[model samples]
Target: MSRALFRSSLPELGSFSAARLRPTAAVLPFSWTTTTTRSFNSTAPIVEPVSSNNAPNPTASQVRPLALKKSHPAAPPSPIADSVKNLLPFLAAQPGHYITVHIHGFPYLVQEGDQIRLPFRMPGVLPGDVLRLNRASVIGSRDYTMKGSPHIDERVFECRATVLGVESEPLRIKIKKKRRQRRKRQAKSKHRYTILRVSELNIKNLEEAAAE
Candidate 1:
């Protein structure tokens, strides 16, 4: 009876060994386990997919910096040189040129056969007397510029106009009468202006002016 009891107990100990000795598969730290009382927690934080330096990509709702346009500054004006003014007499002697001529500080850009109405009546000149205009500031080319002497030589350019005589405008007569006053005075005034038709605009060569 003792030998039979030992044999049964030995079989039960072998069965317990068979059930406890089976190996369990290794579980990764990140893997979830349903049997855990709280879900399996990760010791390491979850890493998201990144673009460049491990920084997470922003969403479409994020604001982006705007590209700015660069503006160009304006160019400065050209300065006039003193050397250009010294060469003007030779330049004026050339044939058929345009000149910016000034008369008594008032500037006029004139060529031949231009008509000018003087602002006020010019005194001491008759129909055929010639007038020489000299003051000029600039003599220009399409690209090059030749400035004149601070004041042009009075004898340099001849701007002769045929004085077409004085012209009178329509008479302006204003009658003065008060609301209660019976006496009325008539004020009459008339203005006459000189008209000049430019007959010849000549920039004579020194040789030509010398011969005359």
Candidate 2:
């Protein structure tokens, strides 16, 4: 009875194990397929290639006509012809001379090697800089004098000055008081000026001024 029961149970066990191990189509519920194709649209806009050779050259574009410009008239002839003729000779014969130089419309009576403190500060100049003074009112020696109607011709005289440095005024203080209140305010100022020395002064000859 025991052997018959064991053989009967073997077939039932084998069939149950085979059902669990079997592959099923239900595992994959859906499938997919892919296809590749070229796309075309007649409404697309076309772009034309630009030609670099058609562009104008940079050098050709820069060429332009130069317009003619009018120039200012020269200064009128010197007013003192007779006085200048005698004065030039006498001025040359003198030993020492002094010139009244006009700097920024202010006249400075100076001789060679005289240091002067200008009223205003000079720009773009440093120590050891040499400046040519062109405008003058008078150039004279001890006896004779040559004066300009307003300014002597710059070509007639050559005056040079050397920059020494800058000088500053002492600090100035001014006090202001309110009429009703006891409050008071102070204003302070320190002004700077340029210093120059007359380095050379020479009277040019008539021929030299005329040639220029």
Best-fitting candidate, scored by lDDT: 2
Kindly report the root-mean-square deviation of model 1 from the true structure over all alpha carbons: 21.6
The CA-based lDDT of model 2 is what? 0.81
User: What are the TM-scores, per candidate, against the unseen true structure?
Assistant: 0.47, 0.58
For residues 173-207, write the lDDT of model 1, one tens digit per residue: 99999999999999998887777776776654566
Tell me the spans in candidate 2 whose CA falls farther than 4 Å from its real position: 1-81
In candidate 1, stretches whose alpha carbon ends up further than 4 angstroms from where it belongs are 1-82, 85-96, 141-150, 177-180, 204-212
